[model samples]
Structure formats: C-alpha cells, structure tokens
Target: SELSEIHSALKEIEELESDNAGAEAPKNLAGAIKVQVDRVIRAYRTLLGMSGHAQEVLEVGENPDEEWKNVWLLLRRDLQKSMPRGSELEKAWHEAFNVDAEVAFEAALEVRDLAALMLVGVRYPFAPAALRATKASADLAFAEGQRALAAKGYSALMALEPFQSVSRQDLALAAIKGYLCTRELGWRKAEGEFKSWIDANPAAAVLWGEERKPIGALLLDFEKAIPSFDTLELQLGESLVSMPMATLAGQPSKAEPKNLETQAWPSLKIKGPLSPRTSYAMKNLLEVEVSPVIPTVTPTSILVNTGEALYGFDFLSGKSLWGDGVRLEAPRDAFHYSEQDPNLILTAARWQDLVIAPLENPLSKSTDAPKAKSSFGGSVFSHFPVVRRALVGVDQASGNILWTLGGQYRLRSDQASLPDLEKRIAVTSFFTLTVVDDVIYALGTTRENESQLHLVAIDPAQGKPMWSVLLGAGQGESNMFGNPMRDAMPGIPVVAEGVLYVQSNLGAVMAVEIASQRVLWVSRYEALPRPFTRIRSTAYRKVTHANGAPILTRDKKGNLLLIVAPTDSRFITAFDAESGEVRWRTQTENAQ
Candidate 1:
C-alpha cells in the first residue's frame, strides 16, 4: 500500500508541471506573460552571444534560418499578452521591431538579391525614421574610414524605411554635391534631382538661384521653378510693347505691335525737342563728318575721318584738308580705316574696287599738298580675287599693293578637292575680319554647313595660306535643334602673346601656337550639352595682361571676365579674372 501511494504522488506532480508550462503561453494567460517571453528571448540572445557568430549569422535577421520563427512567434504572443492596452511606447516598439525583423528575414533569405534595400523600406511603417538615423550614422562612419560598417548601416536603414521630406531633401543635396565632386551622376541626373527639389519647395526657391555652378544649368532650374508664362508676359510688356500714341486727328490710337514692319519704318517720331524738321536740319547743316579713316604716324600726327563729305581732316584739328568730290555712299561698311598710317586714306567702291588717296595739310592749303594715288585693277586679295573678296594689306610708299591675301582657296589639279571645301570656304553674309601683325583671321561658317566653322590664317603679304583649323565636327548630333548636319563654327580668334585663342559654338576654348600650329591648351564649359547654343553670340575683347598672363573676356553672362593662362604643369586654367580663382563652384546636397 505505501509503494502504490508514492507512485501516484509522483505521477500527479508530473501532470501539474506540464499544465503550468501550457498556461504560461499568451493564449492561456491574461497578464505578465511578457516576463516569460522575455526570458526565452534572453536565453536565445545569450546563446547567440556565446557562439560569437550571432551578429554574422543574424545579419539577415534574428531567426534567419526560419528555425527562429517559432521562437519569435512565441515571444511576440507573450509580449502582446503582457502589454497594457493603449500604450503608445509599446505600439511603437512593436512596429519598429516587426519592421526590423522583416528586413533581417529578407536579407537572410536572399544572398544574391540585386534589388536595392532602400527601395524595400518604402513599404514599411517605421522605415523613414530608421533610415534617417542610419544615413546620419553612415555619413559619420564614412568620414572615419569605416567603409564596410557604413555601407552595412546604410543598406540596413535603406531596407528599413521610406524616404521622408527632410530625408529626400538631404539626398537631393547629396546627389548634387556628388555630381560636382565626382561628376558621377552626370548633368542629366543632377538636373532632374534639382528640379524635383525646387518643385517640391516653392518657398525655398532662392536656393536654386545660387550662381556658383554653370549659369546654363541654373537657368534650367530657374525656368522650372518660375512660371514661364508669367515671366514671358512680364518681359514682353517691359521690352516689346509700346505705349499708346495720339493720332493726327486728335484721337488716341492703340499701341502698335512691335514687329519687323513697324521697326523698319523710314521715320520714327518721338515726343521731344528733337523733332523731325529740327533733327533733319541739324543733321544736314551741323553734322560733322564721322570719318572711317584712322591714321597714326610713328609717334606724331594721327588723322581720323568723321564720315563727313568734306576733305580728310586732321584727327586733332577737325579741319578739312584736300577737299574732294569723293563721297561715301554707305558710310557704315564702305570704308576701311587704319590708325597705323596718318596721311593715307583707303576706301572700297560698290563694285569691289579699292582706292588709296593722300591728304594735304589743311593749315597750308597750298598747291604742294600730297597727291592721291589709286590701285584699281583687280581684287587685292587673290583668293577671293573676284568681286566681294575680303582683303587687308599695308600699302608701300610707292603706288603698289605690298602684301594682300584672301581666304578663299582653290585646289590644285593634282590635289583632291574636298566636296565640302567650297561650302566651308564660303563666307557668311555677315562676318567680321581682324588683322593682327600682318596675319588676317576670318570668323564665320563656310558653305558646306551653316554651323561648320573654319579658321583660316592667311599671309597678308603673299596672298598665301599659313594654316587653317576646323572646330565642332561632331557637334551636330549633340545639338539641341536636332540639326545633325550642323557643326560648331569658330568665332574670331583673339591673338595675344603669339597665342591664338579661339572660341567654338560647342563650348570649347582653345589656344594655339601661331608658329607651330599646335594646340597649346583647351578648356570647355561643361554645364550644357552644347553651352554655346544658349549664347546669342560671342564677341571677344582684346586680351589684357595681368600677372604675366593673358586674360580673355567674352560677353556671355557669367563668363564676362575669364582668365586664360598656363599653369606649372603645362595645363591651362580658365577662371574668373577678377577673383583670380575659379568662381563657378557651388555646394550641392549630395557630395561624395
């Protein structure tokens, strides 16, 4: 009987222990079940710690192998049972932990996942907050050379959260800075991000107006940020529209449209003291001839024409000398002036004939005044030997042309002609020519393509070609106008210090050696696909020497004052001439 009782007692004890374990579960218990779940999690963490591989193995998540799923389920159930109702901290903690677990699980499941982790975070509730912290931490780590840690942290955060307004702003800025520093994102991506930011933040529009970067790029952003219709309307009203005017019948007339026809009117009346009659009388009677002739002696007398029909006058006295029947028809483009010679006057006739005349001393008015001479047989410059051929030369004291050259060239019988050479050689209807040190340079496209640029140097003395350089061969494909047949043409080459500086419509500025015909250096404006297209046109002022280097200027807005000089490494630097440093740098949000 005593043995039987002992066995029954032992059986009852075993049953009670089993029931107690079952009751501890969340489904069975009403309160304090969290303690039991906490105990289990602590045990598992301890096991993880002991193994020294918990971080590595659990990188994907705490239960990466799905073996921890049951354990997690148990813990979660117990914690839910243990938590009090309506607890915000508990809710937040649950949400955060759940997201973290999901991220870990996904990471562990796919070792070769090519998808972005940050993109995954977009679907999670707590991702935004987590990502912010992670990004900040990663930034710090990157600075400290902890690359692996930083990367891991960034990936994890990206996987855990969606981007928020503040975070997106930060990312956009980072992207911009990265583009500036590494040029990795490229102009297109950088521009897109900048645009997105501006669109989202209209009140913060001033940030987009920073002129540190290329103006073309900034202009793109500005256009997107500001309403184009309103801006255009404002500009039109300010510049293109005219005010109403009173009619001869005493009724007011509506403002006339500003167009070619209106602008081309023979006479434009203004409401001022300078009326039609007074202006015409004054212009005819008191108009001092503005001469196109500019003459300079070795060091003394310099005579200039004031365009008046009177005889040539001394530049200092304005007194007419050697009055003659010769009168200029088109005062604007008919005459060529040379300040280097004071006594000689040169002019071209409507039919392409040139004449050289000498002026007498106005103070004397004696018959001994210098006699005028003429060289009027053929085109002076042989290349463009026919009518309208461009020419520049210095005349010898004798009645002969000293040195005359033309840009139009003809291929010899044995030499193959470039099919496009004529097109390339053909001068634009409107172009300018400049002569420096007896070498003549011409700027304009020849006939082959409208954008085709040819820079030809001619020997003014022999009417022979010295060198010719072409720019913008492949510019057509990249042009915005979709004209693939076009190319970047050369503007007038500015000569200084034996170096010929040339600007191209393709955004390249090149310096060439006059003697060797070699390219010394080249720099480009990198903001636009074709930055030159944005420029209405280019005009170069004379090069001024500063600090033993030549500084060049262009009329382009930001590039108005640019410096071009050689560096110690044989490289050329183009920066702001005023600052003597690169001025077009800006701080973007993204920097790497």
Candidate 2:
C-alpha cells in the first residue's frame, strides 16, 4: 500500500514536470516538486519507521523487499534529477550535517530513501558513522582507484569509529576494508599488525566472513611489525596507546630509537637572548572574579572579558580605562575554558571598528552541575549545561555594546533574533575566528552539542552569516576519549592558500577548500580509547584536562605541513597538506 502511494506521488511529480513543459517549466515546477518531494520523503520515512530500520538506517540486506527496492530506485532516480538545492529539507539536512545528500547517500551504502532524507533531514543523534556510511564510501573510493579520497575517507572513518554510535559490526568491516585497501595500494600495512588487531579483537573473526581466506593466504605473523607495548617507554606524563596509521596511503614509519636528546638541535639564529622576560606588570585593573580569559590586544588598546564585564585597558600602560568595568548582565562563567585557570587563547575580530568577541551569557544556572568549593568558585558555574553565548561587537573607544549576533544575547537582544531553539543553533563558542577581506570565518561547536562543529562565514557589519558549513562528527557525539569531566577539545582551524586545515581531538586532520567548502581529505591517527591527562586544581578542587592546538608550517621544500599534538599523548603528528597523508610522528609523546 505504501509502495502504491509512493508511486502515485512520483506520478504526480512526473505529470507536473510534463504539464509545465517549456522554458518556464523549472520555475513553475519548483513549488510543486517541493510538495511532491515532501510527500515522497514522508512516505518513505513512515515505511522505514515500520520496517527493518532498526538502527535508524536501512542497508542492503536490512530490508530486502524487492518491490520496495524497485520503488526506491525509481524514486531516487527522479529525486536526484529534480530535487532542488537550498530547499527546506536540504536546509534541515544541512542543519545537522555538512556533506551533501549524495555523499551521505553513498555513505549510507546507496539506500535510496537515505538520499531522500539527505534532501530531507535525518532524525539526528545518529548511530551511523558520523551520520553516514563513511566507511562504505572509502571502500568504494579505493575500488575506484581514488587513493586520496579513499585515504582521507578511511582516515576520518577510523577516527570516528570509536564513538558509541558506530556498531562493532561496522568497525570490524572498516578494519577489513582497511586491510584490503592497504594491500591493493602497496602502502606499508604489514600483515603482522593486522593479524595482531584481529587477535586483540576476536569479534573481527566472526565478521571476517569471505575476506578471511584471502587475508589468511597473505603472509601472516602473530607479532606486529610496529613495535608493541613492550618497546614503549612511558615518560612521567602520558600513556596514549597508538594504532596503525595505514589509511593515509603513506609509508609505514621506520622505528627511530630514542636518540632525540643526542641529536643536534637547529639554531634559531637569534643573536641575543633566547628567552624573554615580562616587560610590564599590570594588576588590580580588574579582579580575576570568575577565572580569566586571554585578552584581545590591538595596536593601541586591549579588550578584556572578565565573564562579568568588558574592561578596556591602555595597551601602552596596562592601566584600567573603565571604572568598575562595563558590567554585563547575566555574564557567562569562564571556568569551562580550563580546569585550573582560563584558557589563555580566544579570538576577537573587528567589525565596523568594534571588537567582536564571543562571551557566554547563561540563561539560568543549573544546580546539578559541580560547584566550586574554593575561592571565586562561582566561576565553576560556567562549566554546566544551559549556557547561552553570543558574538558581541563592542565599541572600542567607549566599551558600549554595538551589535550582538546569534542566540538571545540579553545585552542587546534587539540586534539579534531570539528563538526557543537558539540555545542550540547560534554560533556560540568558536576556537578560531578570523576576518579575511571583510568576511569573518569562525569554527566552533554549539553550547548544547559540543561535537556538532560548524564553520561559518559572516558579514561582521550586518552581524549576519554569509554562509555556514558543518565540519565533521556532529549530532551529539560523545567525548569518549576526552577528559571525563571536560568537554571534547575543539579543533583550532588554520586557513592557508584558500584551504582550511582543522583537526578533531579524536585524532584526524581534515583539509577543506575554502572557495567551494569541499572537504579535500582527512588523515587519521585513531588510537585506542585511553584516559586523557588531567590536572587537579588545589584551589578549585577540579581536574584539568590536556589541551593541544595545531598550526600550519612549511618544510624546507616549500611544502605545507600540518602539525598537531592531539591529546592522545602518543606523538605529535604531522600531515602532508597536499595529500592528507601522515608525513611523520615523533617517536615519543614528549619528544620535540
């Protein structure tokens, strides 16, 4: 019955296409097709809700109804041709995902209705690999001989595979595909390490299925080619276990014994002092009430956000400019930035000559969150849920609120729209914000869903977004590897030569072409979930977690290299920007 209804809907769409046959047909068909596609998507959703879509996904064998399969194929062909971009359905999908529908469809293993939902929206909080069958896409890319795509795809998939949403079956399949791709590409995935992986994971045996024989025939070794834990020497700090980095289509790294201390260091060419001393001491300008924030410095002055107010200071003299500071109502707590003190790095942009800064302004404080038992313990309030923040433009000369964007920023609500859902959607906390040619680029997660990161370009003067793209790993993913008491580390984005390079603390680096917002590649260094390093605060009685940032550098060969020390504590990894492949990783966690 549902199949007949879906056909009727498609027939209506076809008839409308035919009826409006002319140069003006597409213009006329836009509204009608929207309605019909809406019908088609709803019907499929209802059908999937009733059947084998147990994990909120319908795969090849999940529902093998031949008639339904044909119905979907017909619907998919039509929708692929006529489904208009920028529709409400697409907006909803984009609201929750970064990749377009087709890529998501391929990731979902060619589920026709999945494609429809791409034009439509997924019910989010997905159980799939970052909201799609990214593993399947990588496998196809490898089969098609697209090494770069396959490498990056597998890189991203492996990093995200550890999340709770990904099933063990899917993870095992990913590993098997990884083994095959490595073998085909001649990349250095020693059979020994793979066998070790299977040995450690007996579950992979059950899913090995047909691939078992071929993989078995290949030279097998019980010992790993890469050095095992016995060869690992723990520094006094971290014990981040590592995994095979074969997904990048790069050569396996040769073991370098810890001779780093004996190696000669490069000269910095500084003629004079190697270390600098503080030039000025300016205190009492403002009290460290609720933790501290790294101030925004300009050529003439600095803008300081104390979580309760905006303070202006004379850069030349480091003296307070405003008395009592321009106190902000419902100021956000700053304790969440770090465990012991404030995270000293935050960005501030200039719009219409006003300082644009992200400040947390809470709605209501929750009692369930951990409170500080020590001094200025009120700062601990910012660490809890139900916090709202905004990008505020402040008058540099007078410390006046000029304009505020996103969420119901109470300071100047009239300048920004207020929505009940604003708590989750607004551009709240960003790791990096930069203004290039008058357009502001921001990368951060939402207050509600820290893992759902968004990269947005904004018109600072108008306080509106020009366009926004979701980055990776969204829909409320868990920070399984991060410090249990803290949120996942947000990746700091570095833009160069029109490409944006970002890394998830989960151990993957991604490059996006800025002009088209296309994700060029991802290189992953997925490691087994281990306890992250954290520091306990004696003053605040709270534990501080490890935080690392990435930077862009060029080698002597003039090639771009992305270097980052993920909180994983294994090694500081470097990736080739052009190919998204691992260039090198330090032998030890603290080395270099």
Show where candidate 2 strays beyond 4 Å: 1-295, 305-310, 324-328, 331-345, 365-386, 407-424, 447-450, 474-489, 526-549, 588-592
For model 2, residues 1-592, the per-residue Cα lDDT tens digits are: 7778778887886677566545344443556665776587667766865895523434445533322333443344455444344333333333333444445455455553323332212222122423355555565665655554455455545545333245656555555556544543334444334445545665443234355533333324212233122122223234343233211111122232343222221211111111121111111122232443444444345555543345666534456666555533542432222222233234455544566666554443343233433334322222323233466667767777766655442324553565533433454554456554467776655534345556778777766766666666544432222212333334545655567777665566778877787778978875434443332322211111123236577675446788876655477778898899888888565465
What TM-score does candidate 1 get on C-alpha atoms?
Answer: 0.26
- Tally clashing residue pairs in candidate 1: 25
- Distance from true position, residue 396, model 2, in Å? 0.7
| TM-score (all chains, Cα) for each model | 0.26, 0.41
Candidate 1 local distance difference test against the native: 0.34
What's the count of clashing pairs in each model shown?
A: 25, 1
Best by lDDT: 2
